[model samples]
Each structure stands twice: as structure tokens, then as C-alpha cells.
Target: MIDTRLSDPKLNDEQGRVLALQRYQILDTPREAPFDRIAGLVKAVMQVPIAIISLIDSERQWFKSCIGMGDTTETTREVSFCTHTIQAREPLYIPDARLDPRFATNPLVTGAPFIRSYVGVPLCTPDGYNVGSLCAIDTIPREYTPSQIEVLKSFAALAAEELELRRVAQIDFVTGAATRRGFTVEVDKAIARYGRYARSSALLVLDLDHFKKVNDTWGHAAGDAVLRAVGAKLNALLRATDVLGRLGGEEFGILLAEATLRDASRSAERFRKAIEAIEIENDPPIKVTASFGISAIGPEHATADQWLAEADLALYAAKRGGRNRSCIAPSSAETQLSRPA
Candidate 1:
């Protein structure tokens, strides 16, 4: 008889555990080449059909990059075996899921995506918390040596290093969004993909409304707080494929890959509302608004700078008409702007 049991993964200091994970500030981020390369390397070297850089949160496991999984990027925490790996802080190897009492009854094994063998190495941070795992899965039972587990740990080390390196290079120290240079690199790739695949894309350049007044009245410290809050709010609303960056002080940019102007407009309106709703809890409370300019990318786009210029024009129009609104550039190459939306 096959052993069958439903195991409930334990959560320890789950609040601080989540806060520790957030310190990396990597959740819901766009796919990066370094991470994708690692996942692909694991799939090829380990000879598995599926490999993923899985980050486990309170309710779900999100894959920043995956190999052989197609377009699917995540699953609920209940179905995530990585959840168990993180709890051990070491590699968890299951030669076969069906025969394992801990996982035999799990939906991931019995359901459509029938997972059999699994090897997961914990992604441990310098501060000694395992936020997630680097996992490879297949639909067949297989034997893997401890030596193989060592190699998995080595690859996971590289991934952790890449995460830290990107945090220093790409992330804004204050807002925790991509810096201007980092954002440009990502946007360039999106533009190339749009040109090659004929995918819909949009860019938004946003300037905070009356930011100078905040610095003058409440002090630059409060101004910094406001920017940080805005970045956090906007980042939450983005899809995993979307990129948000600090283009400059009190101004930001968002690259909406596989999205249209109508979608961009709705996002802009949402931003407008969210910004208006922010109430900083100082003695003198602070509230703010933003002006957004939208530009749709075309197949023949030349450079990131050119596209940004188009969106900048649209933003200028929004400011000219009045603040706290969004506008579109009307065309890709032209600097001509349209009326505020």
C-alpha cells in the first residue's frame, strides 16, 4: 500500500520571515537575463523538464524566471513544494512524489501538472533566512546523488549573488525601484521584443505634482518619504512583466510590456487616484498628485531616448492643461502631444 498524508508546512516568525524576504525587494519583478540563464542552465544540466527560481510569499509561490514551464509563472503556496524546502534551509530531494507520504496527497502530484521527482535548493540570504528555492521538477522517478545536490547549491549561490548585485546596481536606494540606467536597459529589451514580435507596448513618464512645495514646506526628508511611498504604491499595481523605474527625482517611468494605450490610460487613472489617496502621517500631513504622459511603441522605434521624448511631450501637455491628469503622445516618433485625458 502507498503511504498518503497531507502535510501542513510550518510557518516560523512568518511576519519577520516575510519582511526579510521583502528586504531583497525582488517580488513581482520583470524577468532578468541572469536569473533566466540560471533556470535554463539548471534545466539543461540537471536534465529536467522544468526548472524555476521560485520565491515563496505568504499565499503564493512566484517564479521570476522559468524554463520549460511556458507562460505560467506561479501557483498557490499549498501546491508549492518549495515551501517545504525553505523550511529546511537545505536541498530537499524527492525521488518520487507518489510514494512519498508527505506529498502523495498533494494536488500538484494528482492534478494536471503531475509532478514526480523534485530537487529544490534553498535560496538563503546573507542574514540567514531561506526566502525561497531553486527547484527542478520532472514527471518521472529518478535517482540523484548528494554530489548533484552540491551542484544545485552552487547554482543557487550564483542566483543569490545576482539578486544582491542587481539590488545595488539597478534598484533605487530610496524608492527601491529600478534606477534610470537599469530601467533603460530593461526598456531597450522590451522595445526590441515589440519590434520583433509585434507586441503591444506603452511607456508612461510621470512627474509628481508640486513636489518642490513639499520639500519647501515639510523639508526634503518628507519629500523623500513621499517618493518612497509613491514608488511602493505604483510597484504594487504592476504586473510581473511590467517595469517601474526612477527616471529622476520626483519623476518616474513605467514600461508596460504587452499592454495598450487604453490599458495605459486606465493605469494612469489608477495612479492618479492612488497618489491622491496617500496621506503621510506627519504633524502637517502631506498629499500629492501626478501628471502622466503616455506613448505607444511601434515596430520601427529607434532608441529608448526617442521613445521617452515622445512620452515626455505628452507629460508636458498634461502639465500645461493642469496637473493631476494623464495624456497620450498620439504617435510614436512625433513629439506632437494630445490633449489631456
Candidate 2:
């Protein structure tokens, strides 16, 4: 029931810290095994029932890896001891919550988990923002040894490293789309769901029309600008459930969950129109269009590669039937005829 207004004095550069934290995009995401393992190991080492990898959001402390919390995923920032640790930007050790004036009145201290002792190390980002903490909590108060503190610090650093590495691996460097590998992994899972539930899904494989001409005439820099713009446009067209990735040079792939072939065609048309509308105010004002090949998940396709090949065949048909259009493949084993859009 305490207000945290101006209470956490050590929350340095609040705006920058928030921006850095958002860059990780770890909040509310499914618990990852790496983070869970860290929390589990910390719990084992500290012999505590409660251990978590917590991210301090604007209004709450959200656990990315929670163990022994009994379905409690988050707590309000006002009562969060992890929030205090993040503000301090260092390990916070409170042997007895009742003995500490700061936490004695906290609801978590008086209420659930009845937190009696806590030792938390700040998970600092590379740019010096303390985003959250890797913490161990005990219902009964106890002191931590100096060796225990060192081990906890190492674990916190390990969690930070993993978060950063995963962030890099998830995104495409140039277009900010999912990387090819990331997209492939996601598609595998999506296909598995489609197989189990027989859900309708669509794949679109697209390539820029006359992309090499842009690279040759306007140079690679201009080509990169076109690619970046197109990538952004395609991303905007996607739903939250859909995933698009830069498959490779001048090519991108989209996986539309629960979408039919017609839905896929409609989406592809939108992408083509969007790219065609991009008038780069260059010396000559570069304009571009893209060709799309759409394929629905059917009995013929079981793997990501097979689905992509189906889309590629349709895309080639789009290029052949004149560029700047979408072509959809029939549900047959081979792409015999492509329906142009």
C-alpha cells in the first residue's frame, strides 16, 4: 500500500533505462529455458523456494523466469523488491525484511510469499542501464556468505549475456525483420500446429522486380534503401500472428497463420502496391514493384522447405506472367497452374 513516487532515487536515467529495456523486448514473453535454468540453479545454490529472473516494467516487476511463485507472474512496482535492486544497480541483500525499514511495510513482506530474506543482483545492460534482477528469495531470514554473493553476481551476468545474445539472434540486421534462421524455426512450429489442428496457413515468397537493375544503375546503397523500405512496408501489412523474414538477398518470406490462399493473395497485393507507391526522392526518383508467389499449407507440404519451394514455384510464375503481381499455387503435389492476382 506504499507509493513509489520518487522513492527509488537510484533509478538513473529513467527514460534511457526504459528505452534500453524495451530494446530487449523480454517482457511478458514465454519463459525461456535458458532463463529458467539460471533461476533454477540460483534456487538450488541459495536453497530458497523462490527465485526469479525479473524485468522491471514501468508499472510492474514481470518475471521472465519464475520458479516456486505459484502462478504469480508479476507484482506491482510499488511493492517490488526487485525494482529496488534494479534502481540500486547492484546486489541488494536484506537478511530480514521486517528489520529493513524500506521493505518492512511492503505488501509482499506482509502478504504472499511472506518474503523474509532477499539477495538480488542487478542485471545490467551493456549500456549501463539496470533493467532488472536475478534474485533469490526465502520465506525464513538468513544471511548470505561472501562466496554466495560472488556466485549470484556471476549468474546475473550470465542472464544478461543470454538476453543480449537472443535479442541479436532474433532480428534481421538490415531490415529489422526476423533473420532467415529465426523465421525457419518459427515456421517449423507453425507447420506442426497446422498439421495437428488442420489450420489454414499460407506462405508468400516475394522478390523485388528489377532489383539487380537498381543495384547496377543506382548502386548497392540505393538498392539497400529500397530493400529497407520494402521490408518496413511488408512488416506493416502483417498481423501480430503472422511472421515475415528476409529469407536471403532480394527475397523475403511470410508465414500467415490461419490464412487461406485468397487471404494470402490479398496480402501479397497489398505488399506489391505498397512497394510500387514508394517514390524515393533520389536524383532520378527510384520506384519499384515486387512479385509474390502464394501457397497454402496442404497435404503436399510438411516441412518449411517444402512449403517455401511451393511458394517459390508460384513466385516464378508471377515473374513469368509479367512482374508486379501475385500468383497462387493449386493444392496439387506440383505447381501446374498458378492463379495470377
- Candidate 2 accuracy as lDDT: 0.85
lDDT of 2 by residue, 103-221 (tens): 99898889988999999999988877889999999999989998998999999999999989987888987787888887877677668777788887888899999899999999989
Using lDDT as the measure, the top candidate is 2
The reply for model 2, stretches above 4 Å from the true place, is 2-161, 332-341
Per-candidate TM-scores read 0.58, 0.62
* lDDT, candidates in the order shown: 0.84, 0.85
Off by over 4 Å in 1: 1-155, 332-341
The pairs that clash in candidate 2 are: none
lDDT (0-100) at residue 195 of candidate 2? 78
Q: What is the model-wide C-alpha lDDT for candidate 1?
A: 0.84
